[model samples]
Every structure is written in structure tokens, then in C-alpha cells.
Target: MSQFPHPSLPSSVKEPWLAVNLSLFFPGIGQLYAGKIIRGHSLIITQVGLYALSGWLILSQIGNIFIGELLLITAFALSIWGIFDAYDCAKTANSPSFEKLRTSQKDPWLAVFLSRLVPGAGHLYINRLWFSVLFFTFFVISLLVQLVPILLKSLIFYHVYIASTIRRERNQLPILGMALVSILFSLIISLQIFFIKTHIADTHIIVTNEMKPTLQRGDHVIVDKQIYRFKSPQRGDIVLFSPPEPLQDNHFREAFIQRIIGLPGERVEIQNGRVYINSQPLEENYPQKLSQYSFIPITVPANSYFVLGDNRNHSYDSEDWGFLPRPNILGKVTKRFFPPQRIGIVSS
Candidate 1:
């Protein structure tokens, strides 16, 4: 059993190695590792209680501006407290009081707690480099994944703040409005970036030899969802859009990049090898050879588009799948970035 300095004995145990100042930093943290479990638990509980109280105050909406400020301060203080607790516990882990206790018997609960609480950080203090690296890697990626979006959104919010500040009063309401605007802007921007980064509909290309000569199999393409956002998709503009009805079983749903040969509410027909929209022939410029064979066409409905592959004969586009909704439009192929020889802006 570890010897403790009792009231009757001369104080013989080495002075507490951890500075009392460190304990002041984080309540229960230092005490827990100092073989003072009761005190440490009390501190942790107290901090948690304060945090709960702060959360309640914010949600109550009683003078929210002041409540928000108080909550922020409380959170900041708790973070500082936890940090100091970690420092204190780390420094005194091998103090004299712990010397008589078998190293194996020393409670590592607090260490484990810290590890769980902050991942690699707690392990670093324990000198577990390998475990720390694993923890750090996982947490860093997770943090960056979350933080990047937040930061991007925050950037947008700052723009809103600048714009709104030009007219609004510079009082607390303006500040609150700015904060809310920033948050909303950040969310929208972050969502856009995330979707662009994650969704394949944002990018795709002709993978099969079907669309070759016009759009080569090896061509890498970008889909622009914003193309038809302001203006309607016009004839001859290459559009990337999902098919109204997908062919092939297990082909859940997929987007097709094709040229818009006919617009919504327009009578479209293919005779021999020519495309006529509203009985007028499509104006020419692109690889003219694709128009060598005629296919059946029908009038496109409102909010729908007629799409055809650059390699007209082989592409299974609107001719095979049906009209693409304007909302289905993902983007226009503005450029072809792969296969150096083919690297150029994809022309209409």
C-alpha cells in the first residue's frame, strides 16, 4: 500500500510535484491523477454542470445577446480548466505519493479518460507515439473535413456582413444579425463545396468508345450545374443531365452529357440524317458527320430538353432515354482536361 503522510507524522513525503497553479487550470484533471479521485470527480461534475447551465441559458432566449456572451465565456473557461488539469496530471504521474504504489496498480483511468476525451493528445502525454499518431490522423482528417466547410461558409458570411453593415445600424442587433447571417452563409457555401467535392454528377465523361471522335473515350469532363441556372439551355450547348428514364437493370440513375438539339415546347423531328427543331434545321458547326443518319424525334415538353451525344449514331441519349428535365441539368462541358492532345475547351 502507498504510504500517506498522516496528521501525526512529520510531513515527509516529497512536496506535490505539480504546481498548485496547474490544478487551478482544470478542476478535476490534476486531482484525479494526484490520487485524489473524489476531488477530481467533483471538479469534473462541477464543470459539466456549468456547461449544462450555460447551454440552458442560451436556449432559454432570455436576453439572448447577453446569454450568448456568458455561454461563450463559460465554455472558454472550461476549456482552460481542462487544459490545466491535463498538464498537472501529466507532471505528477510519477510523484513520491505514487512511488510506493506499484506502477501496474496506479489507476490509469484518468489517462484513458483523457485519451477518449481528446484522442492523440492524451496519448502524447503518455509517450504513446504510435497510438498517438493513429489517433491524431483520424481526428485531424475528421476535423479538417468538418472545419473546411465551416471556414468556407464563414467566408461567405463575412461577405454578407460587409454588405449588410452598409445599411444596418451598428448596434447589438446588427451584430446579432451579422452573426446569424454569417452562420447561414457559411452553411450554404459549405454544403455547395461539399456536394461538388462528393457528387459524381458534378463530373463525368464519355468512358466508352461510343462517343469517340467527338467526345473521346479518354476525355475527362466537368459538369456545370450552374449552366442553366440563369439562362435556359439553348440548342447546341453541350449539357450534362440525368436521363428521365434510365435503361438497363441495376442502372439506378445516371447523368448523360450531350448536346441540346431541341428546346422545351419545340417540335423536334429527325429526317434521314438531319435534325429539325420546330421544322427548322439545326444550325451547324460541330462535327457535321454525326448528322449522317436520321432518327425519330418528338416535341420536347416544357421543363424538358432533347439531348444527343456528339457521336450521334451510337450515343444512347434522349433518342433512347427520353427528354432531360431542366432541373436534371448538372453542367455543361466547358473543357476537356485529359489526354494532352485533346486538352482544350469543349466547344459547342
Candidate 2:
């Protein structure tokens, strides 16, 4: 007779590989499919909470590259643990020992709450002395470096640490208080994210090949909203702005990202596939597929900029709609954060 009797088993056997794939989509899903109800729920909650905390940190401090990178690494580690734990849970889903272990597990939500209330408290509650020490060490380093916000760093570390503990073993149902706190934090973070996106910094995806080699379709760039306040827009700077009046009539509602080719009060003309500013050949250094098109020389009005796409032949830029009003300029594209291999400063 099997240690786990047939009557106690799940209606359908869970496949280990399927569980891993499910966890890949989300941390707790695989455990749920494997019949670890409380465990699965805890994992899901932990993952979401960690993500919310990380997003809040990144958005609130858009200039902190170190914090952003550290949070990303923490997230990656959590994902790996989730995938492996899900596979293990599925493999032992029907085992008597696994059932015993599940029932004996501590409450993961309590751990999460303790961690949030005090740094390393969660790990200490679970008797993970090493993890507690490591978390404290990270807290100290964050304080010393002053590069990362200590509060956010502590939250991220504890979140990841608690998540790892939850993955290692099943947990009891979370307390009502824990659930309420989690929901409250998530709500607050969401509101802050909206405010930050509107007034601070945000990410945008390139959908058109207008900027080509410098910015290709599907490239993700970070737009700095505060830069223009400190310095005026300069030539060759890539900018994100709303479509000018003429183009708006054609249903061009979305903002366009292009390079500033002509500055205010400058004589701008395009001829023989080259741009001339004040009749002087503009020294072109960036990658662009220039088109041999001639445009009657025109002076850029005050408080306006003449912009053009890097992919000259295919772009619908100033050549089509006229100058971009200074007020329409939303922000400057400072960095490309996606396509890991191409991650770097987006310089002119």
C-alpha cells in the first residue's frame, strides 16, 4: 500500500515539468496545481508584494541606477527559487512525508509582516540566523553607500528573503491583518507609480523604425522629465514630444521620438541627403540612413525646434508637419534599459 493512500491523493496527478512552467508564468501557480493551497497563495502574495515594492522604489527614484539593478537581481533570484520549488513540490505531491512537512510549516505571512516591520525580523522568526545576518549586513551597506534608499532596500531584501523561506517549505494560511496590510501597501504603491510616471520619469517603447540604428522598433528607453527644466533643448538631442498641430489633424495623437536637427532662430534646410544649419553642413556623427531630399530653407521660429527622424528616408518628422513647439517637448531619452546587450546611455 502506498504511504499516501489513494483516497488522500489529488484527483489528477500533477506533472513536475508542468508545475515548473506554471511557476515560470507566476510563482505560486504551480504549488496550487500541486495541491499546496496555502503554500501557493503565500508565494503569489509574496511575489506580488516584492514586485510592488521594487516598482515603487524604481519609479520614485528614477535616477538611482544601483537600486534598480539590485532590485532586478533580487527579482531574478526569487524567480529561480520559485521555479525550482514548484518542480520539487509537484514531484512529491503525493508523498506522505511531503504532506507531513506541509502541515508542519510556519505562517509565511507572519514572516512577511515581521520583515516589513523590522529589518531581518522575518528571518529571525523563522530561525534563519544566517539570512538574518546577511540582511542586516545589506542594510548596513546600503546606509554606508548612500546610493540606495535604505528603507526601500530593506523592504526588497526582506521580501526576497521571506519569499525564499516560503519556497523552501509550505506555510499556514496568512492572518487577516497580514492580508489587509499587503493590500494597503499595494494600493499606495500603485497611486505613487501613477504620479511618478506623470511628473518624474517613465519608460517608453519604440514602435516605429523612425530612429533606426540609435533606437530600433521594440527598443525600451527611459525618458527624463526633469532634464529640460535645468537646461534648454540642444541640437542632436533625442526628444519625445506630442505631434505638432498639422500632424494632429491626421490622427497622430501619440507622441513622437526624434532628434532635434535645428534650434530656435536657425536657418534649417535639407538638400543632397545632408542637413545644413545656417548654410553650414551639420557634422553628422550618429547612425542614420539619410535620404536625398531637398527642402526650401526655412528659419526655425523662436521657442520652437525643428526635429527629424534618424531614419531620414522613412520618417515623418519636421519635414512633414513643421517645427515642434517647445512646450510640446515632453522629455529627453537618456538610457535604453532593455535588450540587455544594448543597455547603456543613449548619447547623441
Candidate 3:
């Protein structure tokens, strides 16, 4: 009792909610706010590294995949752990036992937010030299993991094909070794590219009103390119594709997404917002209605398709651009991934 003394803290100090909010903004800042400097800094470093690794995997898959999703879940768990730890630290901040190891260090929320935008930045905010160096190292490592493989693969191709220029007199075994290396390198690169182009696709929220009601403004969807490769786009299927002709004047070069109104060789007609296929009205369980528009019956040419937006009146689809050639088809929309309320399999 004589050796130990009561802890004194700022009268205005409110640790609990403040720490919780700080940790929410930046994974470790709340610990710093609650005088757990080392714990806070450690979390800052760990969280940033975890996120960078997760992001690298996500971009490598080129979008959502099982591995990337798992990585993200792990990252989220780390953040939650940090937040709870912060709350605990904050609760004990004013205790005499905590005072012995408590730090006078302060963490600016502004700095935390800045570091949130750029990893290891919060350390720089607090002017921690060693911590800043640690963050920079992690960032460099992240960049290396993301870019080095591609660069190495490119160099291999460049040196073997362009720089060296093939020699016929080379030894058989060495040629075999080079062949094996080239095959292995090519396989790695091809797999990444194939996954990017064929498996996963990411797109922003659609602003075009053509896909209203079913998919409105600020709705985003994931495209699965592998689907079309296995089977052709069928009627009522929502698909994304490079438009037959793009609006080069407006610099709008994005792939277009529209529901397939008619497949190749099908007779399609629209009468007062209702779509008729082969002289029968198409049945749709989805809550999308075509806008009022009368269109003459047209026979879809070979290897071509007729597309229309859910909002028929506002959409500039096959009606404006004629038939969509099979080669122009890009992928099929699998799910809506953005705007939380509308997130789910967008199509049945």
C-alpha cells in the first residue's frame, strides 16, 4: 500500500466507446488510445499485413474465390480480435495496476484514418521510426509477392524467345531442362490469366437505367465467364458482353449486360412491353417488366442474339445496336455482389 499509489487520469477521459471507435477506424488505434502502445502498434502492423496478403490473393483470382474469401474472413477475425482487446484495455485504463505499464502516448484519429488508407501510415502519424520501417518492409513485401512472379515469367519468355533467339545445336538435356522450365512457367502464367479471364470477374455498380427494377442504379454483379464457354446463352439469361459497336465518341468502352430476349434462329417480337418467343409470350418468374415498346418480328441470324434491358424503353441494347455476334459475348451474370440489400444470386 505504501509502495503503490492511486492512478490519476484525465477527468474528461472516456475510454470504452472511444477505444471501440478507434479500433473500428483502424484495427489497433484503440489499444493506443487505452495506453496499450505496444499492443496497438503490433495490431497495426499485423492487420495491415494480413489485409495486403488477402488483397493480393483477391486480385490474383481477379475477384472472389474460396481461398480469397477465406483470407478475408481471417483478416476480419483479426480485426474483431483487436477491437475486443481494445475494449478490454480501455476498461482497465484507469486501474492502479494498469498505471504501472500505461503509456502517455496518444493516437490521433486523423492519423489512424490516414493509415487506414495506407498501411503503416499510422506509425508515421505517431512518429515511430522503427514501426514505420516495419510497415514499409511489409508494403514492399506485398508488392513483391504481387508483381515479382509476373515479371520473372515475362523475363523467362523474353530471354528464351526474343533475346537468345533459338539455337538448333544446343545439348539435348539442356534443351529438355529449358523446355521443362518454359512449360512450368507457361503453366503458372496461363493458369492466372485463365482464372482472371474465365473464372472470376468484377464490375462496379451499374448507373444505366436500362436494368432498372431487377437491377437498379448502384447495383453491382459478378460475371462468370466459364458459363458461356460450356453452353450458349439461353433466352431470359442475363449476360455481359462487349457491344457489337461501342460509343467511342463518349469514351464508353465497358462491357454491356443485358437479358437475352432471343437466341440464334429464334423469332422475337415485342408487343406493348410484352416479349413473345415463337408466337408465344415468354414466361418470366423474375420481377422485371419490359417498358412499353412495339417491335417488329425479327429472325435472329446465325450465331447472333437479340438482347434487351429489363427497362426496355430506357435501354440502348439490341434494338439500337442490332444483333450481338457470338464472338462478342463475354460472360454471364452470376450474382449481385454490391449494395448489401440486393446482394444475392441476381438470376435464377
| lDDT for each residue of candidate 2 in 1-348, tens digit (9 for 90 to 100) | 112223544545554544664564578887997788999999888778777766555444244444565676787788789878887888786566544644555434346545655667777777777877888677767766533443544454336434544333223222232334444555567678787777778899999999998999988888878778889998989999988889888988998999999999999998898899999999988999877699889999999999999999899999988999999999998777777767666768
List residue ranges in candidate 1 displaced over 4 A: 1-129, 132-192, 195-202, 246-252, 288-293
Residues 299-319, candidate 3: write the lDDT tens digits. Answer: 999999998888778888888
Query: How do these models rank on TM-score, best leading?
Result: 2, 3, 1
lDDT of each: 0.57, 0.73, 0.65
If scored against the real structure, what TM-score would every candidate get?
Answer: 0.45, 0.57, 0.51
* Rank list by lDDT: 2, 3, 1
Q: What is the lDDT of candidate 2?
A: 0.73
RMSD of each: 19.0, 15.7, 16.5
Task: Name the candidate, 1 or 3, with the larger TM-score value.
Answer: 3
- Give candidate 2's error at residue 186 in angstroms: 1.3
Candidate of highest lDDT = 2
TM-score of candidate 3 to 2 decimals: 0.51
